[model samples]
Target: MKIYNTLSGRKEEFAPADGKTVKMYVCGVTPYAPAHVGHAMSYTFFDAVRRYLEFLGYSVVHVQNFTDIDDKIIERAARAEVDPAKLAERYIAEFYDEMDSLNIRRASLYPRATEELPTIVDMIQGLIDKGYAYPANGDVYFRVRKKDGYGSLARRTLEGMLAGARIEPSSHKEHPMDFALWKGAKKGEPEWPSPWGPGRPGWHIECSAMCHHHLGETIDIHGGGQDLIFPHHENEIAQSESYTGAKPFVRFWMHNGLVQLGEEKMSKSLGILVTVKDALQKFSPDALRLFFLSSYYRSPLKFSEESVEAAERGAQRLRSAASIEGQGTGPDLDSDPYRRRFVEAMDDDFNTPQAIAALFDLARQVNRAFDEGRRFDEAQSTLRELAEVLGLTLRGLESGTQADIAPFVDLLVEMRGELRKAKQFELADSIRARLQALGVTVEDTAQGGRWRKG
Candidate 1:
């Protein structure tokens, strides 16, 4: 397999340090509010990475972290009159709900900042003791220039970063690029005992510490949205390598592109939002998952009602083809070619849009074979198997409320067929019209009447 490595700025042959296991860590959310589609796109991209790796016979130990404490979390918690920790807990649960609705596989571990306090404090002190970080007024800041190759991952020199002034000047810091390792505690906020009095870990340090504590000093893969590349991930590289004395903190830095809303990025600060909960209500798990896969993982995905509708229509084609009634008759269709195409597409830096195109190719052949009174179970199963690698489910009803109503629709279609056999035209037509109104297509087949939900 070959994947683009942000660290090297090129697509490189992919393998783990051990050549057997993949230690993958993707940045998780702060959980300050409901997760939006942009968040869905981010996590879903990484989830596909994990799933695709495991499909190739490699053991993948995936760890995603939660920023249980943050300025945003504290501010939002204060506004809601709830404890910051409690607020984090609430949205953390909601994150699971959104991911589950999207059929995202749970990571091996979801370590929270609150739970990894000791690990955070120990790493900060290690940096301080090594002269890479210092304690100032109960706050600890990393000496960015003290660490060689600090901006290598992002491919910027210390002088260039300073010129850009990506980090605002702080009077206590020795340089403009220096970032916090541990923040000083304030009133009415969470804190822990550290070498520098009592304080919490900085936004970037929490991820570095969580990775070391969970994955190890050096990991196979580190992934997040593209927006985190500059300061957030660059800072992670500086502190982690400095603390562990490792040459490369992460083997491959895979950053997925952002999901956009028109001209602007889909972000809370932009005041443009579409919650995953609300999206799940309007679309199926396959539809949403397919919508994301329709675009390359590293390309910006645009959101539109028409685009989502088109994905649902494409999902329906797969569903409709699989639902065609038939019995095994003629020769079994060869599916190996389709499988090879899918694997090849994904193997080339996880080109998911190309892989999805291959899936639809298989789906078309399945439907064509059934039309000839010849069934190919192998072909249908191949389509399902390839879809599984992309974390998409083809056989189920649309997730959420529609999933609950599927059986009833099937039953009513069956009853309506019975009424058609009994020559009850009026009642049969009434049932058919109602099903059509609900976007369910009831087709009369020679085998019997079959139905599909749009």
Candidate 2:
């Protein structure tokens, strides 16, 4: 299979370095708040990659790390008046719920930064001993110049990066581009005892340390959002390769483009994002997955109601095609060509848009064959199998029977009524709006709020 390597800046044939299991490490979320659709988009792409790799008969050991302790986590925890650990735990649980609801496969291991502190400190000390890092005040900074080809991943020299970068000068840092390995403890923040004073791991180093401790010194794939190309991923290459003495820390670097909202990229820091929980209330798991896959993984996808609504309709079409029980006793519909088309599209750097087009074409033929009194059972099965490779569970409209979701909808309607009685009109209205957006109409009678699926 051909996959795009961001480091190489081109598509390359994919094969496991060990010629067996694929060790994939994806950068997980910093669980300061609930995950947004942008998070869904990133993970969904990686999940599809993993699913496809496994479908090709290669076992994939995927490890995704949680930035459980970071500046954002500490700050959000402080504002919420809770311990950082507790705050991260809350959001981590929420993350699992939303991801599971979206039908994303769980990673093999989810190592948290706080839990991997010992490995982090050990790696930091190794870098310092190798003259690749130095202790500054109570912090340790990676020497950007010590590593040859420092900016190879990002394809820029240290000098070129500094020209356009706005780096804050620090007295302890030897160079402005030097990134921290271990940060010094502040007055109010989580701290861990390290060779350098009590402090937590820096943003970039946590990922390196996690990869080393979980996946090993070198991994097959290191994937994350494109925004992390510089500084974050570049520094990972330098420190990881420096400490492990491995030429390449990651064999393939896969990055997905950001999800955009109006004009700006959907970001937690910018507070311009729609939460996955809120989105799930308004769209099915199949619809969300189809919407994300409609665009190429490397292309920035604009999140819009119209696009998602259209995807929902497309998903319904696939569902109808797949559920068709053919009664014809004639010859079976030829599905090998559609399967070949899917494999070809996927082989060309996981061209999912083309693969999906193949599925729709196959679905169209299945519908036509069903009408023509020809056997279509195998074609329906083929459609379902290929869709599963993309993590699309064509399990009816909303992933379950109305009876299965009725209790949850009823519970939400009841909660909305309670919110209205408590004078939380805004929250109540929001629930109503979200339910309406999901095609459920709520009627407010003198008795209470009643809901019916449209």
Candidate 3:
């Protein structure tokens, strides 16, 4: 298998540092607020990557960290009149619900920043003791010039970096390019008692400490959004390697493309952000997963209401086809050939769009099998397996949202249909009104009425 390594700026063959096991870490959210579509896009892509590796028989140990204590979280908590820890925990649970709804597998280790303060302090002390870091006032900053490969990741010259950094003229710093490793806690903010006075770990230092604590000195793959390519990831590489004496902190650096609203990037400041909760009310969790997986992990995907509606329609067709049960004596289920196409497409750098096309072809095969009145058990099994490998729900459980709506919708539709046929127009209108009030949208189509949650 080969993956595009951002560190090397090329697609290189994937060889694990350890035999038969792939150790990976992807930067996770800060949990200041509910997860947005951008966070979902990045995590879902990494989940697919991890799932594919596991499907290929590689024991994958995936680690993603939660930055529980950050400036944003502190600010949000203060505004809400709550403790920062309580606010972080609330959003963390909400994030888990979103991930579970989309069928994302839980990571092997999810180390939170608050839980790993000792590790963070120890790593910073190691860097400072080794002369790669310096304490300024009460805060600790990484000495950027001390690392020979400081600009290797970002590929900027020292003179250019010094000039380019939007640095304030601070009292304590050897250079303007140096970034904080430990931020000294100010009053009215969340903090912990650390060796560097009362403070919290800087954003970049948290990941380095977490990876070292969980995945070890080096990992096979380190992934995050494309925005982290600059100061965040570059600082991680510098601090991690400087402390551990490891040549390469991570062999592969996979950065997912950013999420955009049409031509503009979706961001909190831009006010074009879509939260997962608001999105789930309109599109099924599976539809969101399908929409994200429809693009290559490294390519930017533009998201819009129209695009999501299209994906929802397409995904519904797959689910409808998978629900078909073959009659006795239909097409030969064992003779279908679309599985090979799906596997081959996924093999070529996890080209999910091509893989999705293959799935559609297989769904057509099911249609053909039903039209011919042949057994389609083989096609059904193949579809389920393919969907599972993609971390999609082929056959939803008979619980949760599906279960609650399935029998109720059928009963309500049947009653409404009976009333309409009986010419009791007033009663039929009343039933429709009640259903609509309950958040069920009933639309009359050519064949009959269709119902979905509003």
Q: For each candidate in the order shown, give its overall lDDT on alpha carbons.
A: 0.88, 0.91, 0.84
Measure candidate 3: CA RMSD.
3.9
RMSD of each: 2.1, 8.9, 3.9
lDDT of 1 by residue, 141-216 (tens): 9998898878887888987877865566789888777888889999878888887888888999989999999899
- lDDT of the structure predicted as candidate 3: 0.84
lDDT of 1: 0.88
In model 1, the runs with Cα more than 4 Å from the true position are: 165-167, 398-427
Alpha-carbon TM-score of each model against the true structure = 0.95, 0.89, 0.88
What residue pairs are clashing in model 3? 329-374, 330-373, 330-374, 330-375, 331-374
Best first by lDDT, ranked: 2, 1, 3
Of 2 and 3, the candidate ahead on lDDT is 2
Write down the worst ten-residue block by lDDT for model 1. 395-404
What is the overall TM-score of model 3 with all chains considered together?
0.88
- Candidate order (TM-score): 1, 2, 3
- Candidate 2, which segments miss by more than 4 Å at Cα? 398-454
> How many clashes (backbone N, Cα, C below 3 Å) per candidate?
0, 0, 5
lDDT of 3 at 198: 91
